[model samples]
Target: MKRALPLLIFMAISGAVFSQENPIGIFEDNKDIGNPKLAGSASYDETSQTYTIKGAGYNIWGQRDEHRYLYSKVKGDFVATANFEFEGNKEIHRKIGWMARASENDNSVMVGGFLHGDGLMAGQWRERKGADMQNPEDDVWAQKRYQQIIQLERRGNTFIVRAAHPGEPLQEISSKQLEFMPEAVLLGVVIGSHDENVIETARVWNARIDQPVAEDYNPGKDGWIGCRMETMNVFDGKRRVIHEKDGRFEAPNWMPDGKELLFNEDGSLYTIPINGGKTEKLNTGSADDLNNDHCISFDGKMLGISHNDGEGSNVFYLPLDGGEPKSVTQQAPSYLHGWAPNNKEVVYVAQRGENKVYDIYRKPIKGGKEVKLTDNKKWDHADGCEYSPDGKYIYYNGSKNGGTMQIWRMKPDGTEKEQITFDQYNNWFPHISPDGKWIAFISFSPDIELNSHPSYKKVMLRLMPTSGGAPKVIAHLYGGQGTINVNSWSPDSKHIAFVSNSKKSVKVD
Candidate 1:
């Protein structure tokens, strides 16, 4: 969660209009401006200062006779505006401005303000019950000029739609209508042509929406609310340090008894009490070169770690009370990825050959031949493997489509594989909630390059339900390598324990 402190304060002073050029809460499409992913014959012409939308045919969603525009992921109170002129015949049945909150299936709660070719302006709210509630006629039909401005404002679940002629005050087109106000929505400007003729042009400029001023906007709070780099000290509510360090500390897996946190610090495994005290190094000795990936057995007696020992990294098991680690994999190059709910089998990434491509493999902790789970020609690069609380499925990250990684769940045998995340962001290190209803993982925005090496200064932790939905960012902190020490879930599932880093001085001795 990243905070917008200055913007919040600025929004307070100007009724949320912090800037004239780009208001705080509004997003606009000038056709000339913004990154456009336009569909159909809609194209922006900067030279003519217009956006030409040609209606060659009718689209099933009432778009063929209409020119459609789309903007996604809008939240909270906002205003949308557009300017346009019609050049073709008056056969166009509907010219309208629309605001919609679309669901995953594209079904939406649509607010439509339409102007007929005969010069009648009408507005209505489109619901599942069919387009019902229509507003009383104002001046929408009386004007001859094609130029217009349209605006939509939202508060809670209610939306207020308005429109006006050029140089005219915005008149209320519709009153507060109850609708499903999405946390994020899509805004669009549409023009309908009843005939095959083209709708001449729509030009949008100085269009913006601003968010209402919020009272709280601290940078630290912003880090928690937005994706901003900061530090979060993972402590037991009583201020007991589970895993503390100067750099990135991550993946704090709790012992079955919930007494200590199994975490990684500086690429090695360590344990700290729940009450916060000195960290005891888990002396893997030669297996000390470990990564952040580690977990404890269901019985809490054995600890499995992915570590490098002279030859290469592989899964190794040691006693929870600290002892010499015994290598579990016979293969030369394998890295531990996940532990089964039974704690008897461990899943890891196995490199094939000189090509360096990797896939997921599983083996028993009691020393058995490895079983290949995924075998894609391209690198599978499976990670964050964990069995569901009921031991029904194994959730992990897989790179099957090109090189982009996505969350995937498969049966323990590697069958029934399905992609979970569809967003453009990079989601990794999935930790399933103990109750099996949610998954928490690290999310890197499109701004963060995928191939870029992990650094402590940029990254965010996000949460999404295992049932499938948009991921919500939960923590904005500067640590990625070992952000979550292990599967340290609270008994109530209300909180999670993960390690993060800051520059503040501390005495490690």
Candidate 2:
């Protein structure tokens, strides 16, 4: 009996930690043990990627009564995040945050990192089954404030909670140990109305769930997992995932008519509805090996493609509606980036000299000798080069004086070279919006090498005024390479489209 007891305990712990039955997507609202009269509603916004929970419950503490829960059943270590807030003025105790619990029971063993309407944020929990919840161990309490970014991470047997205001990273607030809770538990966005008769809905935005991965995991051999095609309302801070797939897709460019989005998958180009639907193959005739570096001209009448399947990249021009592609650049390793204001000339980055230096070059659409715009002494690497909207300047990214890559711009005539951004992080692809009011670019962390922007790393999409100013983070995502290789700003200049990756582990249902 003694030997058998130890074996039984080990098996029980193993089952809790490594269960494969996980629901790995957005979920609506459901009650644990609440009054049938107290209703709750939940929804996920496909445009802004926000979640809302309209819940009515007395309280989630003090042995529990009624509340709404929207959760995913995850078994292994994971990180969950949300921007949490209440709809309007309400009672001080109205709560909404993130939770991890063993079950939906009213008195289930659980821990919650929640924010109260009265401006109190806490890490509350129940020690035993059906036990009354204890006070949180938060170091400080606010009288009334909303935590815009809330994160809950499970590291082995310990759970850590953190929250911060918008445009800021989550900072640690509290940590708890719940060794008794099952390893396979429900954890996600949570909300409680506090007053069962009056449902003060809770709002959450940028809901993300990242599963644990090895430090050296390879996406090619391990295979890519979940990918979401997302759009962002740059002005209002709203984002949503419109389409999700099991593998990889790259660089979505808004269609000319604004009815669809064109992206690259495998080695071909495809178009899906602007919002999301069945994707149709955009036949490029013989240009089957198109890369993500493709874009439409200002007049929206022509398309440029960079085909890099065989030896080196070949730049081609074709009709916007897809037709027989005509070769544009005579060089072997040229990439198409931008078109002149009148659509009469095309600009790209290519190797022109015996040094194999990557520099900006321009060629007339009606057939002319290629003109090199940038003539520097060293640094064989310069990329993300493109022409400004009005054709006044050419924006590109490269390191100067052997420093970090900075956003630089020069006159279309290749004179008056100047730097735009000077920061510690390596920035790339200074894409100008339609109205020419803002510049959206991708930034990699300082820890990474200056010349590398690898895939599946934590990266940020930052926006700055085109004239130049402080950059603000518009989106924090787990994507690189295919996220935004080309200009994807909508025609109205209100939104931008990009791609983010994830390793989804979904339940079979």
Candidate 3:
């Protein structure tokens, strides 16, 4: 059933803007390639951060290609991802997916992940200008089309594409390396109609372009990238950028009052309205060398923090509004993670004894002997030890024998230990929702070290039922250590606030 593309007229779409220049979400330009018989158009919904591209082309196959591209020029290593679906399509050759090209010439050296109307997903590439397009002989034919997210990553001369359905982990589909490929390329969303006079439309959402730091790149030495303060609806998977800045900031803690969010930047704490506005720094007295490890008490009356006191990081507590922090741990390197539901005690990770292995420990707020919660092995590590809202269990991320990190839970008395998630990814920071019904956590690829949660990497924020079920990917972006170290769920449990990183200097009003 070869179907022709139809040009649908859309006017005054709610919250959407039809533009080719200025701000189009993350893209910088939108243009049509090859000048098809009929024109093409693109739109972006700022509220949903989604893109809709409509194009008419005479097949993007063979020697030359024609399509609509909404793109941004990216250099070096980068990862582009989006969830896309065509509208009113029947042509099996209609194409839509992520693409990278050396130039906008009608026939240019390019590589892209393409999803055809007939459920054929393949990595297509052109070796040189005016060359015939080529794809791997063995292509993935999804049983359910447009139900997965497409990710295209570039590592030097190599390009790779990976896809995953909802509630599942991403699996690599295809990859290729071209020696002639340039360092900079037009990385973006692409759509094409199989016929010249017809137009095809697609809606793409959750679109992200992440420029990761090098393996040896150090923020303090190489300079920091930009930051985006974003909130996402857990159920709908819709993200809204509430704030942006040109520096480093991490770990957003949703204020219990649900009006503002607290985060750490430049070793200090700052608060911003949930809807986006100016940031106000919190007065933490002299305890300024703070890290991302921080949490708000269940009662919302006090704030627990991990501050470096010239020796090492230690746990401290102060009034939620503003005040001098009081020391909670006598030992150095005690990082705060969670506050007891009773608001009388707090849990943190520390290295004691000669082995110096990190493990979970609990202590009273007023001051008392710290009780060791988990007796990890010499090589084992534990972090993000947070208590559920009902106080029934303490959820955290633990790694043993230098393996991948997995989510685990224990009783407040450090009993009834159980491992919740078992996968290849290094899952971290099990933050239970305020209602205690879901556990939201951040995940890193298996390639990363099991013991560390480094910043500036491709990561996912996942959600799963507290009782037990397959975790679903709630947000995919470039972030890591400072992304969601603390519980950032809105008080109503409908939204989550987190930070994402990018090398581009973007400021959303």
Candidate 4:
């Protein structure tokens, strides 16, 4: 179906006022290219922080092509991401997504992380001007007609394409080395009809362009980085960075009231307004050296903290309002992760006695002998264990293949253990939702070592049903250790709080 472009209405939105001189001020520049009967338009919705674009042009294919493009000029390496979908099923080949081009000419060399109207999502590229189109091998193809989370990045000469359904991690769909391409080029969202006479409309929401470090770059050592407290809607996969700081902060614990977040920095725990604000320290008396492992009990009366007490790590309980901490687990190297529903017991991962092997243990808050739930061999280790909301099972991560770490669940008594997740990456921290209907966990890259959960890597926060199913990536971020060490799901289970790190001065309220 064809539509008139001029009839499309474009609205400017943001905390900053946008005028004719500041068209889509978020980007360096943009244009609706290709001669068409109707001009394309872009609109921003302040409430949702989303962009809507309507355009008309011929197919962006063949020896040469035409299409309405919304672009920004950029130089050097960059990462661009957006959640996109067409306005309607106007045409089967209608295309919309992130694009990187060497030039605006129809025959320009380019690569696209695209979602097509026919539900054919692909990473398509043109090697050079007027060249034949080529796509990645079969291993990377994925499809869906609805909204897609697309990411396109350029690292040196390598062009990497990633995309996925919202609430899922972006999978690497295509990668190509374009050595001849210029250091600077045009990049942004694009729309095309696949037929010159036809006009198609679409949207690219929460679009972000990140200037990241080299793949070999090690953050902090190479350069100091800041952190952002981020929350995502579990159902829609919409993300918002609620707070940011000049230095690193880790392990967000959403308060029971949902009005604030508890995070740790410089060995001290602090609370910040959920909407973003100044940080105030929470006194723990003499228990300092707090790590990222911390959680609020189901009753919301006490906080379980993993504190380094000079001897080593141990679990401690303190009043939610901040007071003298009471030691719960006297065993050193014990990292507290979850609190039982009754709030009388705490689950932790520790290397007790001379074992030197980490395993899940259930320790009574009132003091009792620790119960070891895993007695696997020396090569085996377990971590990220927490009681199910219903208090029937304890979910944790273990190497089911004796190499690849998979999510596992067992009775609280350590019986009937079974693997719940089977995939490429090392999945950890299975934090069940308050309602017990969903499970959220952190997933490391497949290239990472089997047992290590390191920081400063590209990782995915994924979601799945509590009963078990294929997991979906909810957030792609540069974080690991401090990202999600505890159950951070909101009380209502509609949202989740986590942390992301970056060297850039990106700010979002």
Candidate 5:
């Protein structure tokens, strides 16, 4: 944080009116608000609307071990204004004013003025949580300061901090864009005291918030877009293009040796080297007409796919080396989603009734009667199902509770069910990590009002700790439909393989 002051025109306004009769809501220090155990004291005068503090051992939050102040019940966006004149012992680390949490003792998106022992005032605008402190290029909010009245304002996700000399116009210190949690935040102001050049008095006035007028708006435009690919490296964040062309290419699954990627482009199955090069067509013959969902077996000896053969879509398996396809399901309206970890079974979403509602079902890979896994009647459309690495759980995303799609997990027998993700965004396509410590998924905002479907535009790929916590966005780009984990973990778990479309559209071959 840096310290620089905004210039102020010396209007002949009386201090009484500025402190007491001000329009914005104000709170003055009354009684001894400073540390009681210490020798310091703080009091407020309602007539002057000024809060003053004097003595040693005085702090904002009453903590004696460190110089921290805590103010609670701070709701909405507001400002804190204070004036301090101090004669402190020589120490460059002394701070004048700052807003922070009472418990953790950390600075937030607020105004902070620091007075170095060398007599220089520095100011800064900080976003500790959102900052990429390790990479300076990615740390857009990090800044430094010198003498200044600092005004910090937060408008929605954007935070602006400015400073100016006692009489000059405020100079912009720094402006940082941030996504703050929608909860009440704590705020405070404090001065760190060192050695004893001590007799000093401070006056704080004009501290209040100016909340913006409410308006109906879409906040999703500011969200990150996820890169959609069938075989994406989750750890390294690399997208491999197996069968990209002038048209749509999708659902890539890795070969057993991880040397090549198999996918569907223009309704035909094709194979391409994992390292990127020309693709070789896998002869689908009369079964060439395929949908966007496909998979490879654990042994890499077979390919299972869903395709429309003149009549309707059906699940089929073919030899990886290329051969006649074997129909695995006669069930009507079945679309392949994923294969079991053992390669002995496959999960598909089957449509039921005239409403076209879908429910998850599984059947033997070698052909057997389908077993219903989820019997919900609320249009339970399930997609991207995969077995946990340990084989204890099956993770998938489904549309339930109206249009809100969320990631869910169930036991192998579809017994114990649980819903993940409570945020307002539409989360889908969950893929658990091989280590089982994390789950990567795609999220699209359903709050956007548009005539078109919600999944068509920008989306985000996020990762969450398997134990449960807020998901962090890892990649932002355009994509949807066929994103999934199609292969085992790279020996290191540092990369994932998934399919994605090229930025430029290509004609279908």
Candidate 6:
């Protein structure tokens, strides 16, 4: 009996330790805050990359609170986001969202963006430890509801909350400056049931933590941030991360066969299975100074690249299976962006003569007079030129006299130019899908310069009908420049591959 008792005690201790271990997604630990009458639990499902949190608490209001928290310590500025959906039982006041707290104590000072069971979206906070929670009445909380995704960001001592529905742009809900908050604090997802006796369950997914770079940070002079390779379903707006790297990688090009994706890292091209496995470097032979401006031919038999030639970039082509690259353009500074449907010619952006203005041009691969497609002299700028699937139009980003950049399409000869996007944001790189029904593009915030698409910035991947309509946001991520510089749509036109950045490095696998 003594031996059995000792074994039982050991098992209980082991179970408790296992519960505290942090093996799930991005969290460091999972535990209940305030110790509710009924214990709370948190779990992660690897298959779906989803988090399920069941919590019992009287409420996350008034002095002292109870909830389940899956958290890690973060210092300085950071942004956290998650999509939440409550399940089973419901109470109007039950809450689920992203949180930043001063400590683990139930009455600690905290601020968060939350969604209530009855479709209430708000930013709630406690200014001081052991103080009652303050929401709409004390601040500018969102009155309208039905938002399922919540984001919380901290800059210095100020915290802001933003919420949005799937496939929509996030709208600011509220902001608060907590002067007493420390530089380092607990940041994670939290769940609470308004009634202590009732346990509420909620599923959370697409949780992300990103740390923004300084205003003057330079990716080339400074260093690059971690990269996340992701593919998203165009119809349902669901994203699946295929791989992550601690350093820089950019501009994923979906192979025509749809079995793998190719991207550039450290001036070398590499390929990885779409589902992510071993990363194999593509043989570029002597042409290794490649940039993000690389794409696969429509027929899937050729690869086009922009390699740095001493002073500037030049277009080159090689077999998709990798071999010695053959020069396509003698002009330095020429960047390959698209290939003609005939496969005998390629489209690029370059400067010629005394104009010195970057414009779209088409040249035969076998050597011929390069035909200029855009005449954006004066102060106008043009780049990211690509041909539509049927070769009916050439899509590109352009600005008139240093104005806001927007997607524009023109005929093969650069005639009948027409603006396709009318948003205030700066849109760049319009990639037409394989089916020619949809156009995917990246948009930078309106605050950014009209002619600049810098790296390590807040951007959105948006989708719109090729025929034209309002564009809907598919993904909001911290990336720019190399995020989607080339055509990345799967052969079926159902998914797209792109890269996002984060300060926190993730597991390579």
- lDDT against the true structure, per candidate, is 0.54, 0.74, 0.82, 0.76, 0.51, 0.83
Residue 118 C-alpha lDDT in model 6: 86
For candidate 1, report its TM-score.
0.51
Clashes of 2: 6
Q: Provide the clashing-pair count of each candidate structure.
A: 26, 6, 0, 3, 51, 0
Clash pairs (backbone) in predicted model 2: 16-183, 48-239, 48-240, 49-239, 49-240, 119-144
Report clash pairs, candidate 3.
none
lDDT of 1 by residue, 120-153 (tens): 5555554442233333421123344343555666
Candidate with top lDDT is 6
Clashing pairs in 4: 167-473, 168-473, 169-473
Error of 6 at 468 (Å): 1.6
Ten-residue stretch with the least lDDT total in model 5:
1-10
**Candidate 6: where is the Cα deviation over 4 Å?**
1-20, 134-139, 504-509
Per-residue lDDT for 1-509 in model 4, tens only?
A: 00000000011122222112324635544566556566777777755667788887776766565677766666677777778878777788888888888876778788787788887777777777778664333114565535478888888878898877766556687887876677777777888887667778887775666555455555435544566677888888777766766566788899999899998887789999877778889988898888888889999999988889988888899999899899987768888889999999999988877777788899899889899988866768798899988999999988733688789999999999998888888898889999999999999988876577766567788999987689987777667778887789998999999977643332211
Rank candidates by lDDT, best first: 6, 3, 4, 2, 1, 5
Please provide, for model 2 over 258-338, each residue's C-alpha lDDT reduced to its tens digit, 9 standing for 90 to 100. 778898887788999877889999878899988778889999999988986476787888998889888887667888788
Residue-wise C-alpha lDDT for candidate 5, range 219-269, written one tens digit per residue:
243222222233445543333333333244555665666577676666787
Pairs of colliding residues, candidate 6:
none
TM-score for predicted model 6 compared with the true structure = 0.94
Candidate 5 versus the native: TM-score? 0.52
Better of 3 and 6 by TM-score: 6
